[model samples]
Target: MATLKEFEDALREHGMNMALALLERLRERDRATRTVKPARRLTGQKMTPELARAILDLHATTGMTQQEIAFKVGVNQGRVNEVIKRGKWLTDDPQAPEAVARDKAKARLRGEPKPKKAAVKEKKVAPRRTNQGQLALGDL
Candidate 1:
């Protein structure tokens, strides 16, 4: 393993191309060991199939604007556009165990089924309720 100072010295002497490749490999290794977050809560709101249907139904029946949906739902108009235009993330990557665990927690809260592996995990990492009777994820 080359010290960063040594690598920088090499970069200064030999030029960036080779040293940069080695630096990138080091960064990749660092990233591999790091506990990366699975999902980013974007400016876009999360819309379940139910929420998607609700938005569509409202628009189809009432001819509401993006601003109207945003106001009614209490999200940004951009979020409404993302939901109505781009889409939501439902079928997420299965390899993400953390995401799977979160989904299991959410499903249990919603009185829904979990997969076999998720059901097994439910007994272990399931959240506790507060004195206020909150499930801890809070309202969307």
Candidate 2:
């Protein structure tokens, strides 16, 4: 089946200017009728006790899925799952696992270098040899 774009291309190929103009007018009318929605959060926000509570409340009170709850709360879906299922980030304690992880992430974001692990020495590999137009055509 030909798509609208394909049909438009065909019309253009056949020099149907009137039909193309009509499509443009229709597109303009459709755009005019479309309702504008407020921009959604693109970046995930730092998860707090309040945010976790909001996620839990949404999970318990509404039929919203983890992704929907995450979107509404402006956090990761996995964070939402943790709050709903495992009950992480429900406290303001800095020693909590989620809080520690969030602190580490913030540190990394602030350009602080993480503690380095013990370096493992890798075995050196010899480069492979290749004949570049040096072998005769009959050489196998």
Candidate 3:
């Protein structure tokens, strides 16, 4: 309950050491009475697509490694791969590459005119029994 003037007078009468001790106690009391919050975690939450694109672009163009960029962006280094490669691998959706590729093949087979379809159909049926001798992966 010491007033500022009283405290000042007391400090003058006492010593600097006593004043510093009192100041420390006052600071402690102030902290205890106040709703002091903890320091915030520096890890950011989310990165927008534009930010992700920028980060991946920076990784692709700069000397800095993906790990360093991921850390800066508050994401895993693998996310750098996903971001750069698109969601092709990391995606869990059922409509991914395998399904889409199947759909495309089906479409290509069904899209051509009836004559070509009939020809391809006959070839598929009359094939030499082995999938060999065709334009395979090497042709691709």
Candidate 4:
């Protein structure tokens, strides 16, 4: 199937100026009628108590799904689920699991070195014996 651009090129090849002008006018009309919505936030907003409460209220009051709530609140759907199900981000406590995770993420984004855990010695395993040396019935 030929696209509009291809059709336009064909029309131009045939010197169909009137059709090309019509196509351009149609494109202008489409551009004029098209409504442009503000782009949704690509990065999630910082979760706060108020935002958590708002998420909860939206969940309780409306039939919005976790994804819809996340879109509305500019947060991850997982974050919305945490807020609704586990009551996460309801406080400003730095010790909270979500807060701690967020802090760790920010630290990672800033190129901070991760804390190393104590190294454990690996257990050595013996290699398995192959059947390459075994004589088969055909060989015998």
- Model 3 alpha-carbon drift over 4 Å, by segment: 1-44, 87-140
TM-score of 4: 0.60
Report the number of the highest-TM-score candidate. Answer: 4
Off by more than 4 A, model 4? 28-36, 40-43, 57-77, 121-140
Question: How close to the true structure is residue 89 of candidate 3, measured as C-alpha lDDT?
Answer: 35
* Top lDDT model: 4
lDDT ranking, high to low = 4, 2, 1, 3
The digit string of per-residue lDDT tens for model 2 on 1-140 reads 99999999999999999999999999999999999776687677887888888888889999999998888878878989888889998999989987788789989999999979989999899877775467777896
Clashing pairs in 3: none
The estimated TM-scores of all candidates read: 0.31, 0.55, 0.30, 0.60
* Shift of residue 16 alpha carbon in model 1, Å: 72
Taking the tens digit of each residue's C-alpha lDDT, what string does model 3 give over 1-140?
Answer: 98987877777777777776788799899988999575443565354556666776787788888778877767677767667766433344457764466467777788854323334333355545675576777798
- RMSD (Cα, Å) for all candidates, in order, is 23.1, 13.4, 19.3, 8.0
lDDT of all predictions: 0.67, 0.88, 0.67, 0.92
Clashes of 4: 0
**Which clashing pairs does model 1 show?**
none
Q: TM-score of predicted model 1?
A: 0.31
